[model samples]
Target: MKKNMGNADRIIRVIIAAIIAALYYTNVITGTLGIVLLVLAGVFVLTSLISFCPLYAPFGIKTCPMKKG
Candidate 1:
């Protein structure tokens, strides 16, 4: 799939995921809500790593710079 996430977007996702992970591990967030957030964080990391966001596709959103033809 084409990359829809730019460098800044990817960095922001990673940072957010890290924060969620930290909260989960530190017991600041617990139980079902924490589990759900942790799962979301995993998704964020996965998307950032691939530079692609599936949800953005349907909405036609792209953060990456367009290539010159």
Candidate 2:
């Protein structure tokens, strides 16, 4: 798959995932909602690392800049 995420997008996702993880670990978030967020956080990290978002593919959205020929 092509990279559809730019540096800013990747950074933001990583930050969000880190926040979610911190909240869960600190007990600031708990139960079902915490679990759900934790899972979403994992997805965020995965997508950021891979630089691709499956959801964005169908919509034709791309945050990555075009390469010069």
Candidate 3:
């Protein structure tokens, strides 16, 4: 798939995922909510790494800047 996420979007996702991981590891988050968030964080990292977001596909959303002709 073409990259749908812009640099800023990808960076933000990575940062958020890292924060979630830190919170979980540091015991700042626990229980079911924490588990769920951690899982979501994993997804965020994966997507950010790939610069693709499946959810954005269906909506035809693209954060990437337009390429100059």
Candidate 4:
């Protein structure tokens, strides 16, 4: 799929994911809430790595800058 996420978007997602992980690891978040957030963080990292967000596709959202002709 075409990249719908820009560098900044990807970076921000990664940062958020890292923060979640840190919280989980530090026991600041635990139990079901922690598990759910960890899973979401994993998804964020996956999407950031691929530079694509499936949810954004349906909304026609594109964070990536347009290519200059």
Q: Which prediction has the highest TM-score against the true structure?
A: 4
Q: All models: lDDT?
A: 0.99, 0.99, 0.97, 0.98
Error of 3 at 5 (Å): 0.3
Q: Per-prediction count of colliding residue pairs?
A: 0, 0, 0, 0
- TM-scores, all candidates, are 0.97, 0.97, 0.94, 0.98
The alpha-carbon lDDT assigned to residue 41 of candidate 4 equals: 100
Candidate 3 Cα misplacement greater than 4 A, ranges:
none
TM-score: model 3 vs. ground truth? 0.94
Compute the lDDT of residue 51 as modeled in candidate 1: 98
* Candidate 1 root-mean-square deviation in Å: 0.5
lDDT of 3 at 13: 95
Model 3, span 14-54: residue lDDT tens: 99999999999999999999999999999999999999999
Q: Which tens-of-lDDT digit does each residue in 1-69 have in candidate 1?
A: 999999999999999999999999999999999999999999999999999999999999999999999
Pick out the ten consecutive residues of candidate 4 with the lowest summed lDDT: 2-11
Instruction: Give the total clashing residue pairs for model 4.
Output: 0
Candidate 4 Cα misplacement greater than 4 A, ranges: none
The C-alpha stretches of model 1 lying farther than 4 A from their native spots are: none
2 versus 3: better lDDT goes to: 2
Ranked by TM-score from best down, the candidates are 4, 1, 2, 3
